[model samples]
Target: MDSLHHDLTVVEQIEVSPPHATIGCKSLPLTFSDIAWFAFPDPVHTLFFYDHPITQTIFIETIVPTLKQSLSITLQHFFPFVGKLAIFPTSTRIPEIRYVEGDSVAVTFAESDLDFNYITGNHPRECHKFYHLIPLLGSTTKVSDYITIPVFAVQVTLFPNHGIFIGMTNHHNLCDASTRFCFLKAWTSIAQSGGSDEPFLANGTLPIYDRLLKYPKIDESFVKNANVETFDEEYKLPRLSGPTNEVRATFILTRTKINGLKKLVSTQLPTLAYVSSFTVACAYIWSCATKVEKDELAAFIFVIDGRSRLDPPIPAAYLGNCVMPCFTLARTTILKSKEGFVTAAKLIGQNLHKMLSDKDGIVKDIGSFEE
Candidate 1:
């Protein structure tokens, strides 16, 4: 662990904001879907490795400036990324992301001495080895009636002469995976076009900021579940630390393998309502994980994008979270049996079918968070 600390060096730390005075004070309130995640302390971390080799001089002179300039321009369109989350101490006052003029996102430039190829491989590696690449959000600070928390940060690490790694850390309450992907698409397009947002403006979709989904009871329930009154000046997000036994690896399931699992599920349960690649993949993984466990009940929880499932249906580009949870539970003994995979598939498929086919609409049970 001590050696891991010495393997990476911080080159520079800077803050990038939109062009001077382009964005004034702006705030976006959190909906029920977003408020459901208010109590979650883990921020989302992502790393992108590009196998482009270049010298340190070229990296600093060319790559660094290009990214910084493009990100600054991109922030003009996605102002919420540079904003801070404002959390009030009482549930009566909901939380929101507020951005004032001159607010910027923290960006770090770093260089690592570790093997780029080995770290990028599919094999399992110590999770701590990659922690240095992820940047931490700014500390939470109290301002009069509310606390402000930084929602997003970026870190770009150069594995000099091997590859370039881009790491991003974002608070979940700010946005979901789809919104983040859209932001990246816009950023990369602007960067490739030499810091000009003309190309992005021509083809990209701008985020919809209107608070579209409205369910007052559901929102109140989620706020109560989050226990907003407990938040104070001392609140801080959980940080990832090193020197642990955890290892991370990626597993790929080929199209043929996925089809085989689908076929197996279809053959056993001909009347099953849903048996797509996703359900089968989840069932297979869940079965494998619980096979060694003792005979006790276990639960599997996954989220479904509610954009299309809502009554009026939300725009694909609507910002913030619009997802609902789907849960499946079964005994470990059943999962470890010979028909474990099939049983798991049945459970997941039925649960999803029931949730999506609810007569009262998909958002009806959103108040379940209070349970």
Candidate 2:
């Protein structure tokens, strides 16, 4: 199933502002965690394709307006989005992300004639095909000046007669996956209530926007002690880093198969009997992707939420970035060997153990990963 060549027609662009007057003259400082993501892609593209259960009239007359209204009401609590990044060069402090009145979020309503099953099927399809369904972070061309950047953009495309797709592109500096998920859940909850008092707060789905709540736990000793490139120094390859030619497709393994993989890893490494499905999958994929040069090191780097992993857990309502990195470096030759999968799995398991059990913290001492 594939919609490799589907037509996407953007019908309307609406700015959903807060339902009530938002208090202005407020600014939230960018946490150290947020500043590090200045150059990275907004962590995720939240996309989902849902089957059409209502007639076009109901969808257009009832669904769209409700969603837009709910979004506006939701923004009342998350008013910072109506804000923009405020930067000062001479200040020792981090730039502030500010919110102002009349600021609005852009939502595009679109239509597509693409085959619903083909576009949302469980079969292998071109990864690029799904790119269009998700809207870009900002509507205008890339701005060298960071002050004017839009932290969020949303797209809603209806696959007429098939299903409807809603995609939101969010900035990492604004919020992480957990926060985004909470916002989405809140929006739906409000919509489900026919736009009454938000059901999220009643259900305990709240977001903490104060940046100072989650202090930077990353130890800077690594950057200060090690003679490494600072955040600004880096090499260029003349072109962006991406596979211009390669097989990039999604894979879904059933629970039984996942259990089988975990069992296989555990059989080889007794200590990693509780390795997660993600660790197992990464181990398998890394082993398959390596060419094994005996000396070359292949690093499997992944991120974990630091909210709960930190020594003193952060508030559940905190909405900004709090991700920490955990990595495993293995000799290409070892990864290509018969015990390759187990070797990689053990490294990941060890990292997780440290992240969870280490008293000092797995997020201590960090350096830039810029290339």
Candidate 3:
């Protein structure tokens, strides 16, 4: 189980079309960043909830209609999301994100009897409660096989007395963290402005569709790592499932604790350089998480933002994925030692420093992340 299951039923499935048809929408090529994730299982779902103390009649009558329109307008600018990914067997060209005039985003309207506060509390709650909120794209069983269904989906689950839930599921190949957030901000801005798609400049941060910033070709290592096995033609699992028997909790480290951690790092090693809050925090957590004995090896994997590191430097507003993961390897015993925290801090500092100073080496060592 990934989260605690709850009773969530769909009332309606709305096909949200782009307010304006996307020009030249037959096929859109995937960037190298996009191609890199082709072999992974269907992308995961994410959810957000809003606390609006409004009556059910008013919510169903007013907010639902506004959301649909705003979403349609948002999709006008992000038409690729309405389509599905295409992989041609004989063609040497990379996969494409294809769409037709009739393509639309699936937005489902749902209502939940589940306690809103129980799921949304800052204190620990059942992780299973999340299973029913977000819509899933599809599911797969074998390591190589996947079900590529819808590219994007949304759910509006009403909580009778508390608030509205805005849940979303996005295909990973299409957007990264930066792109996802921009799309969301666009939706909110339009909805707030009476659900209009006109004067797109008002959104300020439109996504750049330029493919020039991406690598000319897909990195071979990415695919090889994914297909160590073969693709299965069959499907097995349901779209989304919850993790079993696990308690979920959130921990907040106060400023006093953060300062104390920094002090500890300094005391552990005077030579530890560039010890920032992130370094100390990561180091402290890393030391605590690793339980292996002295001789085993442990790796700290960090994903670095690659926007400004490119040759000419890619624009911050440029869309698609532009990030790479770098790993720091050390002995588990050494990491768990009295100097473990300082060593971890130094290790993180070393990798971050390399990101700025030794860009080429890091780029060459880029390997796909597999779990």
TM-score of each: 0.94, 0.82, 0.83
Between candidates 1 and 2, name the one with more favorable TM-score: 1
Find the candidate with the highest lDDT and give its number: 1
Which candidate number would show the highest TM-score if scored against the true structure?
1
The C-alpha stretches of model 1 lying farther than 4 A from their native spots are 1-4, 360-371
Q: Write the per-residue lDDT of candidate 2 for residues 1-371, one digit (tens) a residue.
A: 22423477766678888864656566777766666665564435778878885556666787789888888888777765656555442234355666777777888877777677877777766665667777765532222433345577788887766779998876666877777777777778888888764466788556776654434333132222222122211211121223235334567878998899899877778766448998888888888778535568778888888887654467766877778777888888898888887887888888778876766555443322221
- Candidate 3 colliding pairs, count: 14
- The global C-alpha lDDT for each of the candidates, from Candidate 1 onward, is 0.90, 0.67, 0.69
Per-residue CA lDDT of model 1 for 267-308, tens digit only, reads 999999999999999999999999778889999998888887
Decide which is better by lDDT, 1 or 3: 1
lDDT of 2 at 314: 71
Instruction: Please count the clashing residue pairs in each candidate, in the order shown.
Output: 0, 2, 14
lDDT of 3 at 153: 79
Candidate 2 deviant stretches above 4 angstroms: 1-6, 39-43, 53-55, 139-146, 212-248, 291-295, 363-371
Ten-residue region with minimum lDDT total, candidate 1: 361-370
Alpha-carbon deviation at 121 in model 1, angstroms: 1.3
Positional deviation of residue 315's Cα in model 1 after best superposition, in angstroms = 0.2
